[model samples]
Target: MDTVIRMNRRQILTGLASGSVVAFAPGCVENPTLGRSQLILVSEEQIAQLSAQAWQQSLQRERVSRDPALNAQLQRVGRRIAQASGLGYDWEFVVFDSDQENAWVLPGGKVAFYRGIMETMENDDQVATVMGHEAAHLAGRHAAERASQQQAAGIGLGLAAVALDAGDVENTAQWAAILGAGVTFGVLLPYSRRHELEADRFGVDYMVRAGYDPREALDFWTSKAAQRTGRPSVPEFASTHPSDETRIAALREYLVARNYI
Candidate 1:
């Protein structure tokens, strides 16, 4: 009975994988902002619904700061970056009352920044640096792209598992786990790094267009790099984000190429 169940599972996975690939192939669409094609299997309406749910959950889960000053700063910086993006999202910015040095943007222009990060900004240009980066993520449609990639990878993995099972392979579970890790470190992580780099480059462009000095982006990232000294380092291949050194260098190179430095 167990063997029959296993065989059925393998057959189901195999069929799903084959059908998914054919169905999702046409999802490749050109993104004018990034000047590249992106796999966007999920529709904008679907992403927006998910984003709204996530935003509401975040508001319920995290203590939102009521500080008028912090809220004003975020709104000021966020609005400018949103306008500069030209994506026409109904933008909303909120300050989470956390001491974490982090900020993120959801699809449909829901932006959140931690008070810790906001307090560290020395000027509005520094604020713009972070705002522009979050806005760039929205402009790049990274959330949707990432979802599409994961869906595709799951299909590929399903097919691989079926092949292993059909071959009567030993240690099939171990092989499947290894393949999963390979997909993470090889495909997903690399694309995430690429997304970060893209955001950095275009974020600087948005900053410039919004009348903020792009040089501050250099200083901001360099400071972030300095703060990482003496910390345990994850290899660039295994991490979703580029190393601080790599990001700083890339930003500098881009700024110089665009004559922003």
Candidate 2:
């Protein structure tokens, strides 16, 4: 529901249903959640369901390596970051048996890392940088925000996005369920670019609080972006984060200001 229409400036919308067409506002459409149909269509439960389904599908299709060593390292980093956010622990870190270089942290402290990305991290600090960024997305509640924005923009829940499965997803994820191996690799891995950058910002702060060198975070992302640049990440609208350069530049500025560099 719209509290007010503020395309440029905030204006009070009195009542359109009252038929009192003589109010102060001439060029405004009055929208209210109390009486009007909820234009913000999706519920928190729906978003959660959708994301959870998608994530669930994702984990099952991929080969998950239940490697104790890798899981511990990832959890260590993820927890360090999450703990700083004042969110309690019950963190689950799973390493996927895949070549794709990506990682994700679901809401409610679920974290995952691909074998390829973990191998690329030269040290725990570097891995911590990546983990911090991913955790930031959940810590900052970026996914829920993205879903809200998507609903507001009239983009319905993604076809393969997180929603309750009418039937059943085989294995991997209980949420963020990607349906097929092909789609998981090609489609679901990326997030909206805005979500990506916001994660970066959140990640930077987490890495610092976790006692990792924040300056290296940029290089960390740069390395990942460079690897996938020629392939071109999914288009912006479909993606959850910004392109690599934009993310790098923003972080560069913020980190420099924060003296994390």
Candidate 3:
């Protein structure tokens, strides 16, 4: 009698490693109906788990803003944009009491906005642009994409060794704090340049669909880059985001070529 354990696709390609497994490099998922994206590997269930945990920490650990009307405004704006998304996932909006100008959307329509960014917009359109960008990220499954990349990285590392054992990566701490995602935005993620650009482009259109002018997205990014003033932001190499200047330029090129302005 032979006891043969069948390895899943991920285990097969990844061969064997220490504490890990990987699947074959899959092709990009394309949604022709909506021209959006869908998950090809990592399940939405996993995203929900990650999102739930991260959101709990955000509410408990992060400072929350107290302005009543501001929170209301965020909800209103987020709703309008989310409606345009046509995504049927669970949605949420949260305002954090912070001075840094940042906003992000997690998978499953879990959205958050920092009050600091509220100060940057001159009108609803600008804010809408930002919202659209964040929305684009979720709609395109950017978080899952990042997660997939991280899986690949971990699998690659595992495959480098012998058959995977759970203890191989037990003690190694990552060093992507400067900009990479081991701890921050791309936690356990390693994205390529292509994904970021796609997100940016898709964001512009989402803004348009949400009835906001897409051109301002370009302006918004340019203004942000200009305001950097040599301040240390996370480096692009390790960060999931592109450089400020690069992002601004890409937005410009995208807007001009598409006549979205």
TM-score, per-candidate, Cα-based: 0.80, 0.65, 0.71
Candidates 2 and 3, the one with greater TM-score:
3
How would you order the candidates by TM-score, starting with the best? 1, 3, 2
Q: Report model 1's TM-score to 2 decimal places.
A: 0.80
lDDT of 2 by residue, 119-194 (tens): 8887778887777766766654554544444444444334323221111101123222323434433443343444
Assess candidate 3 and give its lDDT. Answer: 0.58
Q: Highest lDDT, which number? A: 1
On residues 1-261, what C-alpha lDDT tens digit does candidate 1 reach at each position? 011122243544444444453433338999999999998775565455555655666677778999999999888888898999997988888898977777767778878777877887888899899888878877888877876676688733221211101111011123224346777776766776788789899999999999999999988878766776887666666666777888889999999999998
Model 3: ten consecutive residues of lowest lDDT: 160-169
1-261: candidate 3 lDDT, tens digit per residue: 000112233643332232123344445688563375644455555545545545555567667888897788788878888888787777887787866566666667766666777777777777777777667667666656655555554532111111111111011112242223443444432343445566678777777887888867777777777777676666666544567777678888888898886
lDDT of 1 at 205: 95
Which segments of candidate 2 are over 4 A away from where they belong?
1-43, 51-55, 159-191, 228-240
Best by TM-score: 1
As for lDDT, the candidate ahead, 1 or 3, is 1
- What lDDT, from 0 to 1, does candidate 1 have? 0.70
RMSD of 2: 12.9
Over 4 Å off in model 1, which ranges?
1-26, 155-180
For the record, the alpha-carbon RMSD of candidate 1 to the native fold, in angstroms, is 10.4
At residue 109, give the lDDT of candidate 3: 76
Model 3 stretches with alpha carbons more than 4 Å out: 1-28, 31-39, 155-175, 178-192, 232-235
